[model samples]
Target: MAKIAFILLCHKDPDAVIKQAQSLTAVGDYMAIHFDARAPKAAYDRIRKALADNPNVAFAKRRVKCGWGEWSLVQATLNAVETAVEAFPRASHFYMLSGDCMAIKSAEYAHAFLDQRDVDYIESFDYFHSDWIKTGWKEERLIYRHWFNERTQKKRFYAMFNLQKRLGMTREIPGDLEVMIGSQWWCLRRRTVEWILEFCRTRPDVLRFFRTTWIPDETFFQTLVRHLVPEHEIESRALTFLMFTDYGMPVVFYNDHYDLLLAQDFLFARKISPEARELKRRLGVLYASEGARFQISNEGQSLFRFLTGKGRIGRRFAPRFWEAESSLGRERELLIVLCKKWHVAKRLTARIRALTNIPCIEYLFNEAGCDLPDLGGIQSSMSKRHRHRRALMRMLFEYYDTERLVICLDPQNLDLLEDFCRDRSVSRLLEIECQFTDAYLGGHAMRVGLAGERTPKETLNRLLPTIRNDIVHESDRIRDAQFDNHLRIREIDPPDVNARALAAFLSLPEDIARELANTDHLFAD
Candidate 1:
């Protein structure tokens, strides 16, 4: 009977996943690996052969052709968990993780930590009534029926976003259960795993509903666990540390994250690329020297102390990383929007491009599948968008000349940029972020500086909701002389303000939304 069973959902890199599985063999922990059904035959064969000799590791009988934000991801995870449980009935815990995840702590240390804790570790938040994730975005995930992308097998269904915005297609939350959203990765006790398997078998309707929802993987397991178990029995923080780029994408672990990874108290770290072989080697060395009991070895403790400060490593460094900056010559000007409102971002980019020769290289997050053209280097590269935002940012910084860069971070991307820039000295760079104040912007929401440049902070505040309204509604009425005159005379109070409030204000009309939806054909050629 295995003490721990690791269920790994792998897609891109098999070698790293195999190494991760190897690290768990200290106590004869079983592992069930599920390769994506769509993965190339060659890649799948390589993984199978690599683990064929190991009796403890098994391949999932049911492989899923998984897609992001689709039922397939959930299906794959379920299949792996079921396989692991069936294979090792005496396994005390099931650790659900991705191929990209690497064990930072030794297996003995992890088991010891889990042994002492009576609660399941899974990050969760009130998906129904929480301000943690914006209400509009959350509702969109709840109400709208997001379809699978035929091409890349992802949740890039722009049509759903458009229809939801235009027609406001929505369904009431299930009365029986409250929706929960969190990190897809979690470690559950055998009892909890069994309950989940049983809950899933019985609740086909819930599964069907989440089938077409955006990023259902983040919600399905979390919602089920919250429903099945007592609130006190669950620890909301999943013991994994993940970093994000300034653009809210996952940051792939690299050599620069060496100090950060050592400082983290998390048991696992994720999205490590093959390039970080040295870092991977260090982790492998760390895990190799495990004690007989479920605790860190003396060597492990020494390594921790040597890497970090005098005391034991704490959770304070969980979401931090050294900035990977370049000393290139070109003064790169970046206008980064949290991308809640694509049209506003596009318009802002256009305005900036027209005003100056300063290149307005923009990364727009397209929630709605409007086939927006790449206007003057403004990109809608969903392929690149899907990559870890940190990796993407690193790639950008490495490739682009960003010596003197100016970035505008919206509310969502602000913290990400802070973490990404923590290790670098950005004396020449300026970061502009939107903040709410009592002061009004043209009878609308209170505003902050535009793109953090040297402009008068008060004057640049006018570019927010007003510019947002203009782009979202596809109307210049707010930009007209009459609107300006009215704003000067009377301050029209804005509604409840948020990062996405501007997006919600200008609801898409049915005709326009449908017409824009039709334009998806533009990219078909």
Candidate 2:
């Protein structure tokens, strides 16, 4: 029987780590946890005390202060491996994991599967020949010494690297090593583990070279395995389900990703969000007994790619309904109501809410946060900013939820309006030419809120000519039957949108809008 030893490198979330260990421990695998040295002593103690009764569980002999993209992580891994090797003498293989990682399949199934394979499972490719690195510090990482955390201590880290570059203090790949880089996670046999340890002992020069390299945890063991281990004895893939963004940050899985993950046949998945209780439950051994039996769908792959994909702009945005001028839900179907007055915005948003029974936002881009029905669908700190709005839009659509937004594109919202009109392929734009109250023209009403660079009146002054010309031209196109399905605009101007007139103007199917308009006040939430 092949027993597995797990090297767990944990820095945070002792509670989650406890739960994960309990699941794996239930299947009789031995585990060695290396809590980060810099982590709070209380957290480490908590994890240790919680798992104290498990004989198979042991803490590493040494805990090091680990940094992202630093050699300390590999050192921590070695610490955990040493402890596991000593604690579990019969262990035939070992795997690298983190506090965030959770076994997707049952540990017994994982052990059985790995027991049958003699090859080491790791993702590896020639660093010079491959484009595995999508962003930041490619060859420069190896050429220069990184003495600080690249992300947290970015300025100093880069300054030192730049200074080294200026001095021409460069080095080559150490020894006969074929430099390989890929995911940091791997499953190694005891033989391979001993090979790596022996190689480390004999190759102090190589160790020195990688210790200063950027994200050497990704290359150190990977390069060693490829250089020393036979090609056939290594499977150039990791068992862990992992993916990275353009900035090299792992995509954090949430409750909504339950189906997407269950479909992929991987032993474990990491970078799980702490809020993903539902996803954690669903991915547990109880839910995935047969070890992810579902086939990986092409749509799932596209959805994953959609996370890191570029934001569409101009004609590059291919929308089935409306141009979002956003990233998340660019092609999602949407309904946006636009008017000049607050009263108009309220009436439109309320009527739609009454019709859909979903309280839609009243003033989406208004500097002053206001919602008509204000059901609190999307509450944002910078609601007026483009990035925040785009993310909210994505959440609404991707959550299988409905959205009914009423944007009062009063002068203050010229930037948003400009982007919307520029898209041309609109999803749904409900336009109402409501005249401003005479009080505002006479400077009697309060100037309300101040937006960036200009007041509402001033913004209107800049937008009037372009909007007038475009609306007229588009209206003419509507008259000439040039109104395409994608640019779905419904323009209506009633002297007053009294309930009866508003319902008729809405033109909803089965006279639904009419009924809702009539009884809106009675049934309104």
Report the number of the highest-TM-score candidate.
2
What are the Cα lDDT values of the candidates? 0.59, 0.66
How does residue 305 of candidate 2 score in lDDT? 56
lDDT score for candidate 2 against the true structure? 0.66
TM-score of 1: 0.54
Give one digit per residue, the lDDT tens place, for model 1 in 1-525: 227788888886777767777766645788989999999878888888888888788888888898766778888988888888888877898888787777787666777778887888887899866665643466777777877563463345775567677986777666798888888879888999999999878888887788877778888889988999999999998777775543557867786555445445577888777798888887777766666222221122222222232222121344424323432223332323333333344454454345434344454333325333433233346554433344444445544434322233333333344344343333121211222232433223222222222223333343344445433332222223121111110012122222122222122244432332232221110
* Tens-digit lDDT track of model 2 for 182-265: 888899998898888888789889888988899899898899899888999999998888777656678888987665554455
- In terms of lDDT, the poorest run of 10 residues in model 2 is 444-453
Candidate 1 clashing pairs? Answer: 158-369, 249-389, 432-452
Q: Go through the candidates in order and give the C-alpha RMSD of each one to the true structure.
A: 22.7, 17.9
The list of candidate 1 runs beyond 4 A from truth reads 134-136, 150-156, 164-169, 291-525
Candidate 2 residues lying further than 4 Å off, grouped into runs, are 246-248, 285-299, 306-525
